[model samples]
Target: MNNTHRQIAVIGGGLSGICSAYFLAAKGYEVAVIERRAHAAEEATFGNSGLLAPGAAMPLTLPGAFATFAGRFQEEPRVLLASGADFKRNRWMRQTRQAQQQRFAANKLRLTRLSAYGQELTRQLQEHYAMEHENSSGVFHLFRTPLEAARMASLQEGAQQCEVKHKTLDTAEIRLLEPAFSSEAALAGALYYPDDIAGNCVLFAKQMRNAAQELGVSFHFSSTVKSIQPEFGGRVALELESPHLDSRLTTDGVVLAAGMQTAELLRPLDTPLPMRALQSYSALVPVKNPDDAPNMALFDDSYKVAMTRLGNRIRITGLLGFMPPSQAIPPKALRNLLKIAGDYYPNAANYNQAHFWSSTIPILPNGMPLFGPTRHGNVFVNVGHGVTGWAAAVGSARVLADMVAGEKSAVDTEGFLPQDLAA
Candidate 1:
């Protein structure tokens, strides 16, 4: 991989694209990140529920997850919302159901592997840059129901096998760990992962982008990519709608990291992919009493919610968020989120003044991010990350850059190859 004058164009300046730019620049390649937004991390990466939990990287589509999803939708309509008839014909949903029934274990194993690798890569960036994402170590996955407690506790075995350090904490142990949680709460038990950490994902992306720019990476803001076409010897170029730029821009290579929009760009190249945007709701509440807040992160398996203390603010997120990207999240959706947050940490934050947000994370049916080169050779995709985008973006981008530079990847990217997902 001679990097004398090699250049690459990365679409989407979110976490994935910035990471690709950072890694490519580190490898001494001229990289340009063409972003549709005015700033980086202003999209899905902006308000992500920040958890680097490789110990629980399993997809939502477990063996019986479909039943749970269906029941949640029935019990609480706001938990999963569908706005159009197009949802019925969603190939990603259909394939997710099929894969859950057949390849559940395989999917979990692959995600776990990539997530673990990503966690390590993230630590390097933190050490090098002295990151300030409000990183707090250890996460408690609390269970309220007896069945769910037992079911989630079973993951302890797999975590051990994968060498992810963890602990099964009892009522007293959890109390000592984080005394902010109410003892009257109906938590049956908890699985504590000491290695897991929560941080501000948006800050991380912004810092990474700044670092890349410091190393000679260029960024194009408020730019829209119209099309991508293959050129001579399998190279690719992009057509843009910009004021101060040429309508068409040529690049030695391209990595599509624009969330669900990646599928649109690939469609023009006859490589249409199944990528769905699972909208997620997040709230940022200012903490009134920092001492009373849960210093550690908390994940409620039954409710599908997570709460963490980010500096003086508390962030809580829940729901599967299955709706059109353009659809505004109904104001009523906050009821469930408020209920769950109050049930766990009532006095930790001021929810009345909470800032509500919605983000659409790109997801594939199998719950694995698409990585590596495409059939066009010079085109690589780094989308379909879903909720794990924050956790795995850097590692995936590092490997993607390596592949673009014609070098062996630091992580095994076999199961997530483009042809591997072709059905």
Candidate 2:
């Protein structure tokens, strides 16, 4: 099947959808992106931590992870489980436990490979498009205690097995690399991944959108996809609703990359993906003291918070709350982020001028994204990336494009297909 002439509709305007549109357009496919927001990257992409750390992109369900999180819940209480979060009743939680017990090694390998491949593709795209988005190299994973470092045994082993370039840094080395780190804070050691990167995700998305547009891709901003139905002759019909017009657009295929809304769209097609929407929070503040601000990305292992330098500003993001979507940001999550910011670099940023935000991040049971085709022939999915969506976006998009074109993907496609979750 020659897919060069095929017209594909991508249902999202975030990083994943934009990357998919760009990759598909580059492959000679006629692509049209339908975005609900007036502008791109207004949701998850906008609030992304922007830490492209493939070395740290391990599955959350690693060995002893449950116990570690339990300890954290008892001590600091970073994870918030609201009233409606019934762990036993939630199928996603049940499958996550199963994966933790049985498929940790496999899932970790899959994610590591995809993350590394995504990093490569990101560089290639940046060079080809001559795009710059406040990019910075290297990431430091800081630990506050030896106990916290011990909890990462499985992660370290997995990184070693995957051949990820990393080195253990003592306190002196850590201080040498990040002189701005607060000396009063407790410091055990750090893991330095020199290959990882940090940059502005929204800027990258906009740049990719521009590249896609130059490749003859059409973008329909402020357009909403009301419904997607399979039509005759292997075509898909998208019922669109927008202020300008309401009509049905037909295409050869449909890619559901609408972040949290992807699950809702799949329900009508009888292909229910067991994905949970986890609320993530972030605070973006201007750098008050350049001498005290971080120069690159840093992840606090104890708090599970990521602080990344984006040009003159800093983005501090962390905390996963199992709660329903709301316009109001969780005060507890905000406090945790603020505490991390103050603890790491107290004089680096102005806390009063910080912009607080929250977004619903769709996560799967196995901590891996679902890509490629679904049960429906013309319907595909590229969602459930959790928080690593930014790290894995480009590779996932390339894999999806290869799948649609009936070509082999450069990386292994195992455990990423929608059918892999059927078990």
Candidate 3:
């Protein structure tokens, strides 16, 4: 490994930071990853839906987004509702409303470019790091109602404009793909994205961390970043506070990938970012009969449930809405999730021994994440990816790495500037 003196500090050891550090290390930059947790990806990144579905790339601020959200509001759990007093919700709503008009169309174009770029980056990592995480199984979207099925079919028109590969399947066709789904409420038809795949997010992060370490990148797990100060000559210093230590490190460059806890650190620097948290639930269940389980990952759009088969365990994760970070995962939300899962795939798994979990998704109101360098010299951000963090992390990391290394990017990042706002 080349011994480079240009040390770079990365805050947050989740998928975003790990991928950023790994890519920079690959380019011969000395990298240090400071994480608040005892292990990497212990937060939202640990148990994500794990879809590499770039085809699902659509801005959250679409023209009909409000209608879609309103229609499904009653069916969603109470904990998902945003509290009026929450500072994050207030900020997020302002930004979301601002993004509704012509601004949303521009955001969609940016997301399409970024997400497609992200998918390419993931493919590169699978080859570059030689890591295995149950990837390659395609993704399926099952529709319980004809109306829901029609909505998916309409989405295909937009998908075609982006050149995303997908297929529509009828009831018998879906059954042939997964025999376990025999319920009367079983989806009438489905939309399949062959390019989409699943994997263990935590395992992927661990493997990438290992690869980075092999190339001399340092990881300081459990080291919480206290503050960041802009220093002289285009550099920044990071203050770290943790149970066992208090220290500081100076770097030529810094990337803020901190999920929900990013606003405060940016506030001190006068680079306030619009971000919020949307909590979601997931359950891990062991398969009753291995053959009955679906080989391809499934996303039931109507019920908002997505299922992924991870070796011996089936990970069913979905149901999104706004919530405070400190609140515990609601019991009703968990029960509702299990009910939906059973309705979709009755024979796929036995929920008796399932383990329930919940985590927050860092969100920007428009559903587009802010990436690239901030106005402050040498400070960059790659957070607020919402539900697509794991899917988009590697690609965003690659773009940042290229920026840091003074190389040209394959994707155009014109709309991804750190502080760009819509009118």
Candidate 4:
């Protein structure tokens, strides 16, 4: 299939959409990305923990997970959930219930394959195009107790099946690897994934967008698509409005990667995409003493929080809300993050000047992203990546572009079909 004449429109400008445009443009297609923000990565692509660990793509619906999280959400102030009613949220809860241990394992395995594929593509992009994102490798999954070590059981199995390299480290070994863990509280064992990486997804997306622009991919910033409808000859048309322009647009193919608004985008086409939004919070506390800060990415599994060192700042990201979009950060949530930071790496950052951020992530109950065709073969989706969006961006784009170009994808497309989680 010669894609030289195709004009592809991507309905988002975040990591997933930019990566999609990058690949499509690389393949000689006329690509255009429509972003509502003034710049790229201003939404879900911003403020993530920045760890690109394929080993971290575990499913949230493990056996007894619902019970555990139900109790945890009720007991732990950091573990958040909404009691309000949302049609999609309620349906998603039921689907999560159906995705017991068997489905959880299946989803995790699928995610592992996609993660491996995406990591390689990400590496290639960085090496080939000179993309910058504060690149670094090695992440520590710290376990403070034997019970925490036990929780790593299933993830370790999946990592082995994926043939990823890792090392199990004891307390002394962990301290040697990262002295900030020298505190008595940091004692237990941990699994160190050597290939896990950390980088600014927003920076990577901006650089990739520049590369795409050089390849003649048009980007329309501050443009929001009002509606999408199927035109004659199997084309999808977009009615867009912006502060500067209100117009109609059409393309040979459309890829929905618009983050939280993706389901709304597809609704006009009557595509029943089963995804609910989870508003997440994070804080970027400036490093007051960089010399004392831990350089390796850290994941406190017990608290379900992650901390990463990004240059002179400590990026602490965690906390999940089962509700829709909002910028308001709960005081209790911020306090919880501050506590985590202070406990593990005391005096490493200046909490007084910490920067807070919030964004919505689209989650499917099955914990796998949606890919391939929607109601129409020409319409594809690459949303529902959740936290793995940063790691899986490039590979998802590569696969989406291939499918749109009538070529086979690089990863297995079995569980990635459109509306696979619409149960």
lDDT of each: 0.77, 0.80, 0.72, 0.75
Write one digit per residue (lDDT tens) for candidate 1, span 310-369: 889988875566666654666655776777888867888888998887787777777777
Compose the digit string of candidate 2's lDDT tens values, residues 118-150: 988888888988998788888888877786676
Q: For residues 57-169, could you state the per-residue lDDT of candidate 4 as single tens digits?
A: 55543223344345753444534566655566556677766874347667777787788888888888888887667877888877655755675767777888988777887
Question: In model 2, which residue pairs have backbone atoms overlapping below 3 Å?
Answer: none
Listed in order, each prediction's TM-score against the native is 0.91, 0.92, 0.87, 0.91
Ranking by lDDT: 2, 1, 4, 3
Residue range with the least summed lDDT across 10 consecutive positions in model 3: 60-69
- Clashing residue pairs in candidate 1 are none
Worst 10 residues of 4 by lDDT: 60-69
* Cα shift from native, residue 418, model 4 (Å): 1.5
Q: Alpha carbon lDDT of residue 3, candidate 1?
A: 44
For candidate 2, report its TM-score: 0.92
Worst 10 residues of 1 by lDDT: 60-69
Question: Which stretches of candidate 3 lie above 4 Å from their native place?
Answer: 1-5, 60-79, 82-91, 94-112, 142-154, 186-189, 242-246, 302-304
Per-residue lDDT of model 3, residues 1-423, tens digit only: 112336788888988889899888888888888888889888878657777776655454422224434665344442356436565555556667677444655665566557767777777777877878687567777766665465564457656766778888776766676676654655667787788777787888888889889988888877888889988766688887866655777788788988877777888888877666667778899998887776778776654557888888888886665655554666666776777777767777888888987787776766677778777857878887655446667778888888877788777777666756442
